[model samples]
Target chain A: MQDDIVLKTEDLTKHYGGVHALDGANFELKKGEHVAIMGDNGAGKSTFVRQITGVEQRTRGKIWLYGKEVNFTGPIDAREAGIETVFQTLALADDLDVPDNLFLGRELTFWNWLGPFRFLDYKAMRQATIAGLEKTAVKIPNIKNTIRNMSGGQRQCVAIARTATFHSRLTIMDEPTAALGVQETEQVENIIRQLKSVGEPLILISHNMRQVMDLVDRIIVFRRGRIVANLKRDETDGQDVVAYITGAKGDDVADVA
Target chain B: MAETSHGTGGLTFDKSKRAWPNELNIFIALILIICIFEALGQLLPYMNGQSLLFDTKGRFDSIFNEARIKIIILQVSIIGIIALGVTQVIIAGGIDLSSGSIVGASAMIAMSFAQTELVNGNPNPKAIFGPWAMDLPAIIPVIVGLLCGMLAGIINGVLIAYTRIPPFIATLGMMVSARGVAKWWSRGNPISFPTEDYAWIGSGMMPVIWFVLLAVLFHIILRYTVYGKHTYAIGSNEDAARMSGIKVARHKVLVYTIAGMLASFAAIILSAKNLTAQSGMGLVYELDAIAMAVIGGVSLAGGRGSIIGTCLGMLIFGVIISGFTYLKLDAFYQEMVKGFIIVAAVVLDQWRQKKAAAKT
Candidate 1:
């Protein structure tokens, strides 16, 4: 397989009126790479993902998707460009059913205007939804159930299924298993492993050191707004990562390598 | 296994669908209203008590008085038009208290345009309008009314969505301002004697027809269309809706605008039916319409209710009024009862919400 950089960000920065929410940051991911971003509460880990995924605009930077420089104005734009993000807040509409939530903004329309008027092609969507669930190996008794009725893990699984169903080129998950219990978290981890086997790139923003160590191939550390250090899974330990998050390193000056 | 998820889930799964038991409260209230009238009929000497639904004389159709039923429906039908718009607003996590004021203002403006020239040479003295607006087609007034509503809705939407004002405050500001405009239009005197064509639009059962038609249309829109989905999405969780790529602000504007237009349309019907426009025509209509929405089972918190519920609520309102007349209840008592019903409906809604939350 040709070595291709599936995603790249350069000099990405965001400022909330002098807060310097995200200072200059640079990152890269290969087509099948699994990367984990680790940082403290105010380390700008979320800020970086928010900018890259178009949840928030960068004050200055360029995001290149598949080698083309991109500036997405909104999350939908990023989604259409094959980037699906599972935000920390779990932006799923609780009122909607599993299938409806899966194909919410991007509803699979049949017969164009004619079918939209007659029926939603629920059968097609349901079948496809089941297939998507099977691919993720996330079992649910029925697909007709709403997110409000589902467990936290089940809801998280449904959210992940959306990414899998769309076949997004890159998936950005922010604390996907934080709120989940042991069994549910294990289920999510298995799904993550399945994604790894499928050669799909994933960017996991997580604080769980064990999860980060187990699921990702590379660790990218952030302090304040800039990327402080980059380490491969085998090369670095958790203490080294924590030292950077705590700003113990004297590398305060941001010099892009 | 220890229960470790968000909530306990093991329970007997009942296949029979859960009914809105709150609807039963409204039903019980309806029965109680009938009993009140039945008791009053026993004490009152004037009340004949020939039938609960029929008129005083107890005649099947004629003496029973179709006009009374028509009047109650007619009264509600006009404001019910505004309610349709308000429903959309509420569903989208907003409110439109200005709808009633929009009605008053739009009625005055539309009537001014729909004025007829004194054909018999009486020199129409009540004419605040010029000869250019004289004897225009009925459609002219309707279009004008609709436009007025649209303008009010757009202003409310812009203020709330773009300016980031709270819906209640924004629409309340419009409410006061619109009513002020209504009073200023003819300077507090009633605008009388609309053109015959204008009068025909709201005359007889037309208001009811329009109300029903608009309600049905909006009901479908809320249930089946992209607009409907977006409305629920925003109402349920606005932040999530925005993150989902919905143009939240623009859609909000459209929803409020639609509401404003509905109010204006009701205003047109009101002025036409009465053949007169008054500054106080739509006073207190906002409350009544809101009461109807609440009584119909619409959750005040938003994202949970139906148009069918509103329609049923309107029917209940009509029935209660009719029932009071059957028992020869005082007008003051009827008002008191209506007030109580509104409060009861809200309480029932709260109870239902609590139940749902408990389930979660």
Candidate 2:
């Protein structure tokens, strides 16, 4: 929660063949800040995240992570640079058990080279998995169940747990609770609060006004590939936010949004 | 759906601890097929009028019957070797139709170099090879066979990975080209009379032994290794896997190359077993191998299935074929029935997936 400027984008723009997805947009985030990004379905919220997370290359722009200019060719590059994303699709291997899914790529192992053939430190991994689930308050009764067997809420929780475990400098959740029930959504909101309390920077892409207002310190309204209004949580009401999201207001500010 | 728990807790049903009886399911299927055969033997007058699994006549050690079983396993094992790698390919969300063609091509290419120079101390009339290829170490033909497989596999991997061509199309193209090369290798004649050392490679049930051994080895690798996990992950979700820092394209190439090499090795075994290599050696073998993979519970959709399943699938295939022969059914009828079973296996797989998806 040190008020250090951790990430900044300078005239960040992206285009798709001739479609101006993001036109000379600029944004910034300080350390430990929870920022909410809101926009209509066609608006550039996802495109912006894609560019920033290196899921897609920007047609034209510069991105700064940890105040250093960085160009990422792919999401792996972004991840290696300390960016973890919980995409809306919930990219989880449905076939694997919970603990296995938790530590998918970067598995913790003993005996280095012999790790694959060597015995997995199951107790340690299981214990750590349990602790992670507990910390996120994502109760699934059994951690051995595969994601395919779990409820939507549990799957969402597992994806979130991955972010927590990785401890990325910037965590981008693309509508993390889009498919959850009321109770599960509330649980996710609570986890977001826990994230805020720990001073972890998060970029929450959501349409839920109540959740956004309750969770974020600042709201960045995007419309037609432009950041129209950057307002403090108290400055913007849900109605104004909806106006921006739906092109009712802030149309005059910029055609990009 | 029921709630489950873990550790020393009440109502704790750890799903992982509750191992899936996938192998058991396969075993049950095998038994059911055998039971049908037994029932037919009793009902029909011309079924050798005996038990299905055992040779009731007591003419031999039942090892003769066992030998037939071994042969079926042996015949499929060569292709089963290729199927091992193919199972991984299919599990990783791709199909390799070219493996069959790779077998024929690699077999022809390797045998050309395996020809003996002196037939009774004179120049061998049937030799397509130069004198340099004659009397080489046993390792030469084996190495040549393996190299052809490796080369074919690498090409498959490159086309599928780098060019971003669909696996089916790329492998289909390879199928035609490889088979053509097989015919062209010895000008449409069969290559025969390999050295004594080469013959030992596929002597008796060694192909089956190698198949079983490779299946076990690969099964362990798939279950325990990083390569295995990544293969599953990539199959499950390529985008997510890539984002997770797995080199998806490179791994895919490696997988296909391995598959190609396995098919060629199978070819090498086939040549040794038959003592000849004809252009038509591996014709329709791909379909049978794929059928075995499907019957083993390998979802063509990827991200599921096991080597053990495929092995069981091969057994099922063998039993069905054996049943047809025991019943004195026409060879044409058996071929027709086999085609039906392959389609049926796919349908069953689709239905099971639908049911699972519905439940979820």
Candidate 3:
């Protein structure tokens, strides 16, 4: 049963002077589970995700991925360890086309047998990008278009598609559907469901209640930089999560840490 | 983040009125400037009508005034090489102020090695070093100049990338220090009489040849290589690039080093052409090269420049200067007009960016 946990963070904390952006956050995601992190704007939901994804270093924490303790100094370390992230900003180079964005740092290089003479395998990257987008059901008609020329929904889809390219042990999404339309939100939900079906663990940070209820298997509610409730999908409703988030109920912190 | 999401609506771009490539617009601007000069040649109240770019009388080897064209190319080529490196630097979201001084400093050091072993079958009179260092192979001075440039560039890179000194300040410091080194070497005296082989490097149209070759090579690198991608990525948004796992610091260092080496090579060519090395050889060359890059369409804002644009930029620069001289414009007026053109080019660049933004 312990082997099923894909990600676990022990006593994760962050501080900025007198402000505790995140204090003693403890969470876990099981293999094939889809967990939604929910809270108000300043409740440390994004901060908790930041620590696990190595977007920022925690003041103190022990992150265990695949049952081994790891300290990721930066996002690159976490990414190389099979932790893919869809940042709120998407992290795409706006001037580059879709294929270039998809393979920004980890580009496929051909003629590797010739050492420094190795060149970008653009054809291979393009094909792989097409396949990834198709698998995610993203409908980008012109793949050569740069990100600066894309719609909000299309940009979000490209980010999701990029994360889907490799064998990811865990995927962390920060407001993946925040800027999307209703139809696009539904499409993203389908992609998250597919990830669940394929036994890929997920950590989705979202504010949309309806989408969260429809897409997630578990809910972790935060308030005042602390975890207030942990409820299974069938055990709680939107109102119950909101109570925990707003301190109308479940004000006593859960033994989450 | 808001700026990047609104994609360029590719289908709509084709339907819009402004469908020409941006580089084409620059080309048209260059031609328009030529026409303007040609009209001024006819309109000005002078003793007689004259031609700026065309041969008024059949007195040269080419359709154009061969001597004047040669002078324009010779003047632009050395500076154009530096602009190539500056293009990369600006594209990487950094500025280099030391390139001119690097030229000066490297010229002094390299020319010392390029001195001929003999003076009319006697021991060399102007040798900077003992005979052991004199009469060295031509490659020796070329290597020395390039290494001096590389070392200066590495220092600039380290200061900017690792120490977090702002690029302008760091390279500015290098500028002063490098010029100082130039003056210090050979105690403000000029070094001349390079060997035949060394002199041949810059003799008669060779600088122009070298400039064109480097321009093409760098154009390919920026267009098709991973290094180009990373450079654009860094300039476009550095924080985003770092998050994406591109080694931002190392790449920045490499960009500056390459820029340094190019400036050094420019210095070597300058010395070879003049057949001497003076501490003041490359003064203001940095600013000229930057002006060319900016004029060509290498956005100082970074991530949005190209080498071909810089080449065209050099041409525009050359034509404007030569045209001014041809019309017998006062040197003072020429300086003022050149400044005006640089400002106008930047304004045009900003307008294009705004139009692109509005379309999205």
Task: Provide i-RMS per model in Å.
Answer: 6.2, 3.8, 5.7
The 10 consecutive residues of candidate 3 chain B with the worst lDDT sum are B6-15
Local accuracy of candidate 3 as per-residue lDDT tens digits, A1-257: 28998998878899978889988878888889999999999999988988887878899878899899889988889999999999888788777778888888888886666442357888898778766765566656467777767777777877887877776789999999887888878767877877777777898999999989998899998888999989998999999988888899987777863
Q: Counting only residues 3 or more apart in sequence or on different chains, how many pairs clash (N, Cα, C under 3 Å) in candidate 2?
A: 7
In model 2, where do residues sit more than 4 Å from their true spots? A1-3, A15-20, A23-26, A59-62, A108-128, A243-257, B1-19, B55-65, B120-122
Model 3: lDDT equals 0.86
| Docking quality category of candidate 2 according to DockQ thresholds | acceptable
DockQ of each: 0.26, 0.37, 0.37
Please identify model 3 stretches exceeding 4 Å from their true place: A1-4, A10-26, A57-62, A67-69, A111-118, A179-200, A252-257, B1-20, B42-49, B56-67, B121-125
User: How much of the true contact map at the interface does candidate 1 reproduce, as a fraction?
Assistant: 0.20
The residue-by-residue lDDT of candidate 2 on A127-216, one tens digit each, is 777766655556665677767677887788789877776667999999998899998898788778877888889999998999999999
Q: Compared with the true structure, what per-residue lDDT tens digits does model 3 show for residues B1-360?
A: 223222222221111332355677678888998899889988997917688777889776767866777888888999999999999999998999999999999999999999987878887777899888887899999999999999999999999999999999999999999999999999999998999999999999999999999999899778777888898899888987888888899999899999999999999999999999999989988989999999999888787889988988998999999998888878898779888887987898888778767765
Candidate 2 residue-wise lDDT at B69:
68
Provide the TM-score of chain A alone for each candidate, in the order shown: 0.94, 0.92, 0.94
Tell me the tens digit of each residue's lDDT in model 1 across B163-278. Answer: 89899999899999999999999999888778888898888899999888988888877776667777877887788778877788999999998899888998999898888899
Q: Chain B, candidate 2: TM?
A: 0.93
lDDT by residue (tens digit), candidate 2, B4-116: 44322222336466656667788799889989988999889765577657667677645246655665676577878888988999999899898888899888887777777
Q: How do the candidates rank by TM-score, highest first?
A: 3, 2, 1
Stretches of candidate 1 off by over 4 Å are A1-3, A11-24, A59-61, A108-128, A140-142, A224-229, A234-257, B1-50, B54-72, B119-125
Candidate 3: residue B3 Cα off by (Å): 30
Enumerate residue pairs that collide in model 3.
Answer: A148-B7, A149-B7, A149-B8, A150-B7
